[model samples]
Target: MNSLSNQSRVTYSGTGRRKSSIARVRLIPGSGKLIINGLPGESYLQFSPNYLRISYAPLRTLGLSTEYDIHVKTKGGGLTGQADAIRLGIARALCNINPENRSTLKSEGYLTRDPRVKERRKYGLRKARKAPQYSKR
Candidate 1:
């Protein structure tokens, strides 16, 4: 029917944000294969598996399975931060595909970007303010 045809034709592009990182993602119907800046899926192995999993969890949760191709360009943060950014991008893309699912994704906290990072160490401190080993006899 029209509904089935409409769902199948859905495709989207979205941006993801997490910490100080950002990722631009494009979603297209295809076998599940992730491409990062033109590189193949294997290239992501350079990053931690945990990071990759976090970024891909939303897609799997949607039951999309091997039916969507993701292309992303991410930068401006460490691997973990990049992963979180990518996760946000994918969530947004999915929302675009079907706006009705926004509530579900929102409830899972996928739409919000985490805004926390390590503060810079102050000057003249062993470690952020250790003050070396003080000893006054």
Candidate 2:
């Protein structure tokens, strides 16, 4: 009962990361539905249209927006990072579906991973880049 075996459908998977967030995405043929961490995408994202749009960008680029169901398990960072991670994961899964999808996804810049991350804090610094003021008598 834990897994679906009735359909025997093809499943494609990919992993994405942004900032500190990591997402594992799976694609399966079905009516358009997005599930994240066992919750519906809309509610999980607090019904933010911007977040939904960002996460769905890759599928929209391929014109296969309604043809596949996206299931994601993500952790770390915040919603924005997670959303971008989902986008990259979906793009990769789409490429797994068909190599031809790579050109489209790459041209749309969905295949590129954002390398920016929080810098490590140095000793005597208030934050990663902020430091205590030096006073002159």
TM-score of each: 0.77, 0.94
Report the alpha-carbon TM-score of model 2 versus the true structure: 0.94
Query: RMSD in angstroms, all models?
Result: 5.3, 2.2
Instruction: Give candidate 2 misplaced runs (Cα > 4 Å).
Output: 1-7
Look at candidate 2 and tell me the lDDT of residue 90. 94
Candidate 1, run of 10 with poorest lDDT = 40-49
Q: Write the per-residue lDDT of candidate 1 for residues 1-137, one digit (tens) a residue.
A: 98998888756888988778889998899998889878874476375677778878888778885879998988887777878888899999999999976888888889887878666688878666667777797
Question: Candidate 1 lDDT (Cα, whole model)?
Answer: 0.82
Superposition TM-score, candidate 1 onto the true structure: 0.77
Candidate 2, residue 110: how far the Cα is off, in Å: 0.2
Mark the regions of model 1 whose C-alpha exceeds 4 Å error after superposition: 1-11, 124-137
